[model samples]
Target: MAVAAVGRGASCNAAARDLGCATSTVVSAVRRYREAGRGALRDRREGNGQRKVDERFRERLTRVLQRTPEDWGWCRPTWTRELLCLELERRGLPQVSVATMGRALTSLGARRKAARPIVQCPWPAWKRRRRLYELKCLHAHKPPEEPVLHVDEVDIHLNPKVGHDWCLPGQRRVVVTPGNNQKRFLAGALNVRTGKLTWVEGKSKASDLFIQLLWHLAGEYRRARRIHLVLDNAAVHTSQKTRKALAQLGGRIVLHFLPPYCPQGNRIERVWLDLHANVTRNHRCRTMDQLMVRVHAYLAARNAQRSASPCLRRADLRRTA
Candidate 1:
């Protein structure tokens, strides 16, 4: 307005009065308009200026961030923002603040993620055992008269399973959980041939529960001449009572124990993950009975869909077989 008024032959003092500003302000605006045109009239705050660490240094940091701390001769398995800044200094690079380092890492597709714990096998024969198990799984599809099955037990607590969920920014989601310490044990078997699930829910995963699951499996695949059951080496599975129960089956049920600490070799482990993701994770059932009902319903729905459901199909034992 000041510039337009001045352009129309109004005096600087008159233009300032019309725009509600001092004459010096009007003179400054006129000078800016003449020097840089109308864009200078817009309000713009001054920035903090260029980053301390330039693009070249950030490129180097990205490469270092791609690797583990141990890869750089550090004893630690992971990297922290503070440690990363220290590393930059040690490597003769420009030092950055922890906050700045975090931003740089994020721009390079890095994220602050929790490490997933894995069971390590210290046994020398672990490789051989794993290979043997893989071989069994590979050949499990053969022999149309018999089918292979992977069985395992998963424990679900009355406490709500906390998992990721979308929420408002800077807010956390709260899930209601039962105060009483109650748990339900689920013993389940996945059929490699048909992608069917045979399961039994109980209070405890004891030898008796395992035996009952085995009987259920026997009843499920009654037409098969032999059932090749693959399971983990849980204490209950190899107990004296379980041995007696196996004896009663009379060679109809052949049990194959996976290598110790190698849950990855058991295909049913994937099924349990699917169950938790679908029926339990981020879910809050008011009562244990309600939780059980939901679990059973989820299992039934998945079984009905069979290969059609994404979760069931993704974890399909038939693919492993």
Candidate 2:
């Protein structure tokens, strides 16, 4: 057995040391291998067992990966290994281990990811009432057909995300070789009421791109009676240059910012979730042009058919225990 292990690429000295009989015992193992064929070294249980994610699972894994978290009523897009293990267990394969669950996701070309940051900031009594009053007034004044748009930015990477495949949990990642020399960003907006999406490629999260995204909305929404923008308090959103650019729009679009640290109120939060689930999971772009192309394609396709994924809605937020 020791010689068989060594012949299969184990170090000879290590093999001899492990078997603990003698180097000559390894010679016996080798002779047995020569006489009895490869099966001489097979363990007693070798042919009697199978792994959990054997042939029966491949189809189920494919369908599971293709479905969004919202499709299953999960309140988040990203799936944890625990979630996967539970899925397998619920399907009557209770033997699936967490490690095996991870392997299955990797084999399906999905990356394990944490939930995105989503916090609803609290407002002081005064500001809270003032905003509620403003919302009430706007609600009363708005025509029945008016719509609200929520806008935000999300980042795409340079490298294919690393340490996400065939990797052990808790292993620290080494490096992220920048995929392309250039960096890119995305500016996105969504209709909160109608679940429509609008997105464009951006050079960076500059005040200019921010303003330009607003301009794009204005041009696209020229016929709407009023456009109320839901926003979070990013520095770019409040930049002087962006404000100047907004001023140039002649008040055609109204900005309704969530209180500080409160990004959950923006409907674009849901759009970004959908973006990753449908397009960005394990995405690879070797060049900046390729990155831009994929992003644009994703945006265009989603704009044509995107629904606000139920996972990110305010109603999906769990009540405090």
Candidate 3:
């Protein structure tokens, strides 16, 4: 409303503040409006030239981004603007400059980011699908008297997990780590029906730690006839010692192993990820005790948050399930 604001005798600075834009922008807009009526308010670039990045180019770029630079016979593993232009040329598409390629990528909402590592299950597709279906059915149709939990373990360290953070233009955030890192391990179970979490920490990520978590789960869910845990095939979870602990617990706790190499199948994995993101990443806690304190505090806060809201708990249960 630069024209309206100027019509009311507001200064360019005042109009700019009202519009949340630069003063010069308001001045230019008012000048244009005065000179050329309302038509000048429309985009002036409409008839400048033929568009360089059209839907066809954007669609091609989208397909290219889904694959890697290596797929197009490039030695490099990652895509760069220059390499993208070259690949487009090789594919018999109209060649563009590096800058044009960047603009096109921006338009397509593509970004340069670190690749996440994933492990594919080695099982045959049918076998994997069958096992996943079984797990889904187990989660959906398990007896109400038996509680199902997604179980996983996480390592906590005196050394902070480094991650990105906001900082001044030329400044970087630093996290100090104890040179000789001390470690703590947490075994956690996330309830499938509710969003409740039960966790126990130990000095080592061993069979003892897994058993301790089992004991905690057994106690926490004492009312249930059996506690069904969906866990990965970690050595600690399948060890002789762990089996003995389970036997001693008298089948009160049953284990359901997920398809091999599929951490995504375990809902508790997301809890561990949130643990890292919220408490452990770039943490300034100097000692193992301090870090553990922070970790426990974060988990406790999370549990409390989950327990306080019924609607949120239901939504979380659905999302994780």
Candidate 4:
């Protein structure tokens, strides 16, 4: 507006007043426009001192982030802005200030986050990869008569699951606990194709909990010749009692165990996570029964939304004594 006002023969002081800026600002803009004909309006900092965080520097920073500080002979395990600056300088790059390094990391979409603990799979790399490939092929190319399900178990407690929640600044949200924690367990199976879920609850996450889920699946998928259950290798799953239950089923259900500690392969793990996030996390239910009711309601709604077929009948979700 200032530039246009000046172009329309208005004085610098009038243009500055109309644009709510100082007269000197209007004068400088007009001088640049006259000298370079609009190109001068572009950012003047383009050629400012050789770019500190150029493409090559960003690539090196990314590589450095992938490794630990120990790899660079630093005593610390994690990287800080000052440490990052020092590391970059050690790599023969131009020394940048801590603030500059912080801005560079922000530009690279880096964030300071708590590191998650994970267990490494004990199987050899080749064996693990081959098994995962086999499972993938089975899931993709399974016969129509055979149904594949990713199975897993989760625990529910009367004591609310503590997780991140939104609250006003300087205020924290509180979830009252039951004082005495009461727990229940759920074993669920997620359909690979239809995304339907079949689950059963029990007092404990024992072999019977898994067996109850197996029976529930058997009843639901009666038409399927073989119900292939992809599950983690939990001890209860491979227990003698579980084996006996499978034997009684007469090969109608087949258990395909995933490599140890590989929960990512089991799709049902995501369902349990959603269950916790939506129903169990920060819940205020005072009794296990109340909590279970809400859990059941959430699962039923989820199944209704995901399954084109009819939802599971109420009796099917009965808790095992």
Off by over 4 Å in 2: 1-141, 162-181, 307-321
Higher-scoring candidate on lDDT, 1 or 3: 3
| Model 2 local distance difference test score | 0.68
lDDT of 1 by residue, 183-218 (tens): 999999987778888999889879989999988878
TM-score of 4: 0.80
| Per-residue lDDT over 1-321 for candidate 2, one digit per residue giving the tens place of the 0 to 100 score | 676587888765677888776777677677878899777866666665776687678667667667765677778766667876666566777467787777777777777556556555577868866775665466456674566767888887666544344558777545545544566788878775556677766777888788888888888888876678777778898889988877888877788877777554455777777666544555555566755565565555555555422223222222210
- Report how far residue 203 has shifted in candidate 2, in Å: 0.9
- lDDT values, one for every candidate: 0.81, 0.68, 0.85, 0.88
lDDT of 1: 0.81
Model 4 alpha-carbon drift over 4 Å, by segment: 1-48, 307-321
Question: How many pairs collide in each candidate, listed in order?
Answer: 0, 0, 0, 0
Q: What is the C-alpha RMSD of each candidate to the true structure, in Å?
A: 9.6, 14.7, 6.3, 6.7
The list of candidate 1 runs beyond 4 A from truth reads 1-67, 70-77, 85-104, 125-141, 307-321
How far does residue 208 in candidate 2 sit from its true spot (Å)? 0.7
The candidate maximizing lDDT is 4
Each candidate structure's TM-score, on Cα atoms with residue i matched to residue i, is 0.71, 0.51, 0.80, 0.80
